[model samples]
Every structure is written in C-alpha cells, then in structure tokens.
Target: MIKKITTDDLRKMQNKEGLILQGCGGDLQEWQDGINELLANENILLDGSKFENCLSFECNGITCLLFPFEENVKLDTGKLAIWRLRSHSTFGGTWLSDYVPNRLGGYLAEQQKPDCPLIGQDGNIFNLMGIASKTLRRNGMADQATEMCERITQTAGSYYEALNIIGEYVNITSAEDADIDEDQGMVM
Candidate 1:
C-alpha cells in the first residue's frame, strides 16, 4: 500500500524551529547529491515505475516531504524524480524546469498524491481553503464542496494568495451576509 502524506501530516510535524528533516543528510548541494546517490543505489529503471518514498525535511519553521517519483533520465532508462513536495500539481511543469519528470506512454510520470497537498500552508491556509470551498458552494458553483476545496487546494499558492483570489468572487448581496446565486445569475 502507498503511504499518502497529506497537508495535515506536514502540519503536524511543525514546531518553533521550522521543519526538521529525517533520513536526509548533507548541506544543500550535498543533500541533493545524497539524493542522487540514493537513486544510483536503487538501480531502478525509469520504465515508468510507480514507486515512491517520502523523505521528510524541515524548512522555514515547517516540515515538508522530499517526495520522489519515477522518471526516465534517458530513452528506455529510468530514475527517481525528486522534489520538495507541495509541487505535485506543477510536477514536470516545463522542459526547462529542473524537476521535470520524463514523459512515458504520452504522460509525464509523477507522484500520485492529493490534488491539494497544502505543503506550504498552515492552519490558516486550511481555513482559507475551507472558506473558498464554502464560498464556491454557496454560489452554487459546484455540487461537491470537496471539489471546490480541491480546486482551492490546487490553485491557491498560499492562504493569503487564495484569499485574495476568492475575495473577488465573494459578494455580499444583502445585509444578511448572503452570497450571490451563481446558477440564477442573481444576487441573493
């Protein structure tokens, strides 16, 4: 079974001194070099393997995952793709992107994780995500609040970032603090 690391999981690992890394060693370049060494040690082919491992790290008073997915370094060759997590949505974003995963079977091979991993966000981020989700629901944008939350999670660069974006759509039509009715195209 695959161990899924949620945003809540990252949150729980936080304290005063930022994120504490586990099973990771060396300075910045050395740490990266260590990861490369791990890949070489694994000797796994980049044949689009679905293998993944969560290496935890502390950063800026928060703990984040050093999540690695499988990728092809060369044609018909395989290697482990690595990232600081929280970038699941933008994984393999562009050709110039250092974290770009090799495309196989017409799709970029990436780590299978939640749409809104909330890597950089804290409880405040959670509240922002929730509010965005509720606002979307009250506006009748979608049937499932989970979907709206997922959207917020996927696009929200951070709690403040999402708040600014969602704030635009949140309209108070009356003193009752009622939200606008998107389906009827009217304010309620």
Candidate 2:
C-alpha cells in the first residue's frame, strides 16, 4: 500500500511525501505544485534530483493541496528515497543529533545530498543502476550511467562495476545539477 509522508507528519510515519528536496533558489515550490497537481491518478518524473526519483499521482479525489502518494518512492523509483527522506531534516525537525535511523546506517540526517544513496548489496546496486539507466534513457539523456556500467562489467568486472558505475555517475554531477531530477518539494 502507498502511504503519504508529509513534512508535518514525518515524525509519526514510515512513508514520506519527500518534501525536503531543495535547490539553488529555494523557490522550487512552483515545481512541486506541478507534481502535486498530478497526484493519485497521474504521475510525473520528479524534477531537481539526480536519481530521477519520480512519483505518479493526482489529487486524492478530494479538494486539497496535500496529495496522498502511495508506493511511489522505490529504491531508485520512489520507495527508499522517501525512506531516506525521513532520515533528512528541514528548517525544523531532528536527525542524528536528536535521533538515528539504524545503528550502522549512514547519518546524512543533514539532508543536503543531491540524491539519496541506493544502500544495498551489489545486486541491489545493479538493479538500481538499471532503474537509473531506464529513467535517464526515457528522459532522452545519452544513457551515460548504463554505458559506463557495461564498460565496467566487461573490463573491470562486477566486483569493480558498482564502484566504477558510481564513480562515473558522480564525476558528471555538479552539486546544483545533481539534485535536478530529485524531489525538490512536491508542491504541485
């Protein structure tokens, strides 16, 4: 089932709407409004994050700006992204200093990453790489992520594939552009 994680209810929920994503101007609310407009019945590619974590939904069939999204945040799709978002902090809220996700999990509670990491084993990384490849390919990019993945798999092998894949992806991302396709506040 899909749960709507709002910024206000984040503390008391498991899933999140992923409203913490931000960018240069901090005026991304307009972009968010567009996404929110498509909640429930429709979905859209989340703008402003590097991972391309898009969510599809229209309104709740009710009249309200707060859209209820379900199962949208997958590993690379929309699931884990929102999971990671709960670990993030906004102007208010608490994180590592105030709380911790898992004992050994990363404590980016800082909430300042272009995108959340794909946290998992090599297999998970491979799967996530596929998702990113497909999303970017669908977006009409040059498919750089998959291209490098294939290269690494063929030459450096699978052991180094994840590292190389991540290395390649990281090399091209500038801080500002990194979060381009991520959730920069799902306002619409």
Candidate 3:
C-alpha cells in the first residue's frame, strides 16, 4: 500500500501512526534495504513488515517513506541516528506522531484569504468570476483560481450560486475600499 501524497495532504493528517524515513536521496532501493536492515536489527520488522508497506512521497526533492503501523511501536533513536549518518543524509526517520496535527490549527494557518471586489461590479456571473480569478492569480494562487473557475463553470446553477462559488475562493469586497476590516460584516 505505497501511496503517494503531497506535503499539504500530509499536513492535514491527524492521529497517523507510522515511522517516517526522510532525506532519502539517490538510490531508493538502497534506502529501502538499509531501512529494512535497521528494522530487522531492532526486531521491529514483522512477517508482513516490508518496504512495500510504506507510503512513498517526495518532499523538497528528497524521498520519504512512511511505514504505517496498526499497533504502537518504538524504534531506537540512537541506532536510527547511526543509520542516518551511515546513509549520509542530513535528515532521518521519526515517529509520524511527531508530525501529525492534533488540531485544525495547521489547516487554518494554510488557508488563503485572497480578496476580490464584487460589490458594484457588473452583476454578470462571468464578470464576477473573472474578478475573483484575477484576484486569486494576483495572490499567487493561480492553480486555485483555475480550479475555482472550473468548479463554477461545471457546478454553478444560477447567478447566486456562481457568486457563492466565487465567495468560496476569495473574500468579496468593494473596489473603492482599500482597508476594509474583515470583522466588519465582509461577505465571505
């Protein structure tokens, strides 16, 4: 079950029990063998425990492995450090519990609140969408802008629905207002 995931997806995860081996560069097979050897030496490798059972993803150009454990397990930090040094990688394995977010704080922190001026603009849905998409692009969220436009075009049922869809990606505001307080009844 070697699944691939983005760092954003990883950040949103909670209560995940696993061993993460990071900073694996170059030969992935060598890293896998090294990890297996380390685990076997530590008596952590069970009959089903293998490199194939780990989730694989790349973070910042380095490969990472997540060996998900159904039961609580512990690895020797001293030996893990030695393995990391032997592998010549700057980073090493850690309990996934250390990275798992216990609350919604991480997700909230990552949320983007790009503002769009929809007030007193052409009430036409396309025009409003263009404004919101441009705002998203200006905020360096061009992917989000594209996704929002696609979602609106495919799913919006009416003008109000289109406005609601636009609102999901950006804060609707007045073009004349430069410093509108978000706390002061700004439409979401």
The clash count of every prediction, one per candidate, is 7, 32, 0
Candidates in order have lDDT scores of: 0.39, 0.37, 0.68
The list of candidate 2 runs beyond 4 A from truth reads 1-117, 120-125, 170-188
Leading candidate by TM-score: 3
Q: What pairs collide in candidate 3?
A: none
Higher TM-score: candidate 1 or 2?
1
Error of 1 at 185 (Å): 19
Q: Against the hidden true structure, what lDDT does model 2 obtain?
A: 0.37
| Candidate 2 lDDT, 1-188, residue by residue in tens | 22333222333234443333222122334434544443322333343222223222222231112222345432233533443355334322122222223322333332221232343323465665665565445444343545656666666656556665555543223334434444575211
Q: What local lDDT score does residue 16 receive in model 1, on the 0 to 100 scale? A: 13
Please write out the lDDT profile of model 3 over residues 1-188, one tens digit for every residue.
35666555566455455667776677666666777776777655655355455667776687787766654345554665466456545457665666544321243136667777778888888888898888888888786789789879998888888888888889887865633555566533
lDDT of 1 by residue, 1-188 (tens): 22434332333332211112333333444544444454455563234332244344343344333434324232222222233233235331122122112211122333222222223334475665665465556545443456446556787777576655544444312322322233456444
Q: TM-scores for all candidates?
A: 0.26, 0.25, 0.44
Among the numbered candidates, top lDDT falls to 3
Where does model 3 exceed 4 Å of error? Answer: 71-91, 100-188
**Which is the winner by TM-score between candidate 2 and candidate 3?**
3
